[model samples]
Target: MEPSEHARLDAYWRKIASEFAPDPTARPSSLLVTHLLPERPAFVRAVGAVSELRAVLPKPKSVVAAARREVEQSYRVDELTRERFSDPDDAVAYLESRAAGERIILLDVGGYFAPTLNELCTRFSGTVLGVVEDTENGHKRYASGEKLPCPVISVARSPLKDPEDFLVGQSVVFSAEALVRGRGDILHGRSAYVLGFGKLGSSIARLLHAKGVHVTVYDKDPVRRAQAMAQGFGVARDRDQALSAAGLVLCATGSLSLRGEDFPTLRNSAYVATVTSSEDELELSGLPAGYSRSAVGEHITRYETTGHYFYLLNGGEAVNFLHGASVGPFIFLVQAEIIAAARTFTRAELSPGMHEVPAADRSTIAAHWLNYWNR
Candidate 1:
């Protein structure tokens, strides 16, 4: 870590040591059903240590073959499950069958299985206290104008956007560089359109502009659009026109912002990718796509549309994540946020609506993360 990063972390960890030292044995005994990527085994073990982890339902989209192996080798969680399954539905069913009289708690990522979430709340009823989802896209399902059956806690909108900016911004730029590594200068003089002007989008735009690429940013929220304009980025006054003229279209919105209807508005050569959706089902499944594996070998799948050819890099997964760079070293802090959010979700006296992670918990985690980051 840099000297500044070390100093920042030292302050946080010092507070953590003074305030909240961990105790593995004092965890509450509760049934845990999780659906997430397998990249973070430390996350699995941490949550398991705090609960009776019954099953680890690894979502296939994010949990690549190597991730499955990592789960096996690194997840030494003895307090919960020992089996792994490909199907999230089976995991849900198993949890349902065992839900006759149990206190169930869900630890989810990307909220890939909304049907599963609905099922758990339906089958378990009052027994399931709440669920914690770490992705904005997943939280959107519950936060939408639909009736929810159980309590939900979302860690996606955590106030700690600075660290997230560090993780996601660097990851996207790194991946983009990787994509153009052997291709001989594809990024320099190209126009790129980024959807959403939030932390990730803004950072990506700044980085691409620094590379002399023409960058335009679009956002649904007026405040966000204004923010983009203030940052001196091209604010897309006309979405269709901006998208169609771009050399690249990066979806950082984390919502279902891009769809089949929207694809007609993009250039045939535009390299498209999404950032926040953790599953094919949540974000990519709805796109009107007809793609096949590219013989060109970069995992660049080719799609035929608009009487021309467009491409979906990494099979419509997050571009940054496609090259094995999703949540990097800063995940320790993110997991800390999730841990605090999950614990707060259970005990906080909030209503049945969406809520941020408690301020106190956020402060505590930030402090702890500072300590960890310094080291």
Candidate 2:
């Protein structure tokens, strides 16, 4: 990076560190796996304040050139891609090699390395101090696995994350609107379907409704469906029917909510977007044989199969990530919580299992956030 860019980033990092005030004595060696976007520098700086950052595993789709360069200059950079780590086993092998007998904590997003971290915890018990997961999908991944041997600290469900998720939902809509508008289309007054009524999904659905779009929501969980209905949004009883009728579909579910079978049911010219970070949320590989896919616009891909065609925004990854994955300084609240969780894990003897950030840590982080932003 240029001298000016370096100085600016340094100033920004200092600003964040002063506000978050990470514990200086809680420095655990850590391997960070997350999106490498411009906003990530502050997160890295905050974590580095209380953790010995050994390396970074950047999610391929979320990498921004400038951020990647800065991180590479400061720490080891390992790009997580199919070519680098063919499968979960390969990823595990690489992580083990990287650990090199060090007792390091794993900081992850989307649980991309959950299986690897789980195996490491067993193979080299205690050497893998613990894991700090940032997303709900990662939380679910660790939750679904067999009993974990080390604590898996999760900030996914923290009330502190609500502000970030809320803005994330807004960004999803904003990006979708920009893409649609680029094609001479407008989101206002359009019929939309939101697949998943989870925190992010509900936020997206509500934003779309507020913009005068007719929003229909579907979730496999009956409770979520009821919640959507209670919020006065249309509840989709028949998934395929809703897809066929809506002009836009936004997926926030961290699972394979849309696959080949559902693609053909989409309205011919409809646009699809996702708020989840991983491509597993859409499962484009499930698209039937003879399907043709091509980039139709910046961050938009056109997929055609069985006479049905639709656009996939941001290549089926989180649409908000196309622009920096930021919700402004509020995101640093969650980042601060992650640091606090890491500090707690290193200092306390918590038993192995899924763990939430302690209330005290969250309270402290929230207080700092309020003080910083309210000033």
lDDT string, candidate 2, 1-375, tens digits? 467656654564465455444346545678888787776865776667666787888887878899888777777887675444335456656666676666688888877666555566655523778888989888888888788878889999899899999999999898899889887889986799999899999999989988999999999999999988899999988988888998999988877778868887788889988887546688677777777888887878898877778888888888887666578778777887777777777678889899988798788777766765665
Q: Write the per-residue lDDT of candidate 1 for residues 1-375, one digit (tens) a residue.
A: 367754554454344333432344433323433334443554565665555565566644445565456656744222222222234556456666544556656666655445555656565533666767777666776677376666777777777745666578767867766675534547766688888777777878888888888889999899999988888888999988888898787877767667666665667667776665424322445556553335343756666644776666666666676665555446656566656655654454556656666778777776666656555
lDDT of 2: 0.79
- Candidate 1 has a TM-score of 0.79
Measured by lDDT, the strongest candidate is 2
CA deviation > 4 Å runs, candidate 1: 1-39, 64-67, 73-92, 98-100, 116-119, 277-293, 305-307
> What residue runs in model 2 are displaced by over 4 Å at the alpha carbon?
1-26, 82-89
The TM-score values for the models, in the order shown, are: 0.79, 0.90
* Model 1 score (lDDT): 0.62
Candidate 2 has a TM-score of 0.90
Query: Please, what is the whole-model Cα lDDT of each candidate in the order they appear?
Result: 0.62, 0.79
Query: Which clashing pairs does model 1 show?
Result: 9-370, 9-371, 12-367, 13-371, 53-80
